[model samples]
Target: MTIKLIAIGKTDDKELVKLIENYQKRLSHYIQFEFEIIPDLKKAKNLSESQQKQKEGDLILGKLNPSDVLILLDENGKQFDSVAFSQYLQKHMNSGIKQLVFVIGGPYGFSEDVYSRANGKLSLSKMTFSHQMIRLFAIEQLYRAFTILRNEPYHHR
Candidate 1:
């Protein structure tokens, strides 16, 4: 199955972007992986929080296809350990999902429409993290999950 990460805005931190790219590159060895960035909305200052989210949600939803499995990276979502996550990915691959899509929403969070569209949600940790940093974390976790699946030493117990 192909795995795609869709996030709002580009990473401004060079170091974080490099790390995210590194994990993304490693992911290509095992699967068709891609990271697509949705540019930040213009004139956000004039928009209300809900308005901004709705606009961002439109962009987010626009990238999705009907057959793609949508998963949101949300704070209140299910949390899985490394091993469980590997199994979660394995299950999806075995289930013949065409594309697995995970989204990291904008600064304020996701729109109601965006949340309702998702098939599942995953939480990396209870602690809050910058949206940019979460992108890198998700990619790295994906890399680690694949390694665990293949019994590679990249993920330690």
Candidate 2:
């Protein structure tokens, strides 16, 4: 199955960008993968948090195809170890899922509309992470998940 990661905003940190690229390259070795970024909203200073989420949600929803299984990276979502996450990936692949889409929402998180579109939610940690940092973490974890699936030496326990 193809896996796609969609996130809001750009990463300005050169180190983080480099690491994200590294993981993306490693991930491509295991699955059909793509990373798409939604540019941060313009004039966001004037919009209320709810308004911002609504506007961003529109763009987020627009990027999706009806058949894609969307998983949101949310603070209140399920938490899993790398091994479990790899098994999760394996289960979906075995189920004949086409494209597995994972989204990292903008500041103030996803709107109600965006929540409605998701098939599930995953939490990387209880601690909050910057959207840019989350991008790196998400991709790295995805790479690790595939490695664990293949019994590679990248992950222990």
Which candidate comes out best when scored by lDDT? 1
Clashes of each: 0, 0
Q: What is the lDDT of candidate 2?
A: 0.94
Give all TM-scores, in the order shown.
0.98, 0.98
Per-residue lDDT of model 2, residues 64-108, tens digit only: 999999999999999998889989999999989899999999989
lDDT of 1: 0.95
**Poorest lDDT segment (10 consecutive residues) of candidate 2:** 148-157
Clashing pairs in 1: none
What value does the lDDT take at residue 97 in candidate 2? Answer: 84
Clashes of 2: 0
**Per-residue alpha-carbon lDDT of candidate 1 for residues 2-37, written as tens digits (9 for 90 to 100):** 999999999999999889888989999999998999
Error of 2 at 96 (Å): 0.7
Off by over 4 Å in 2: none
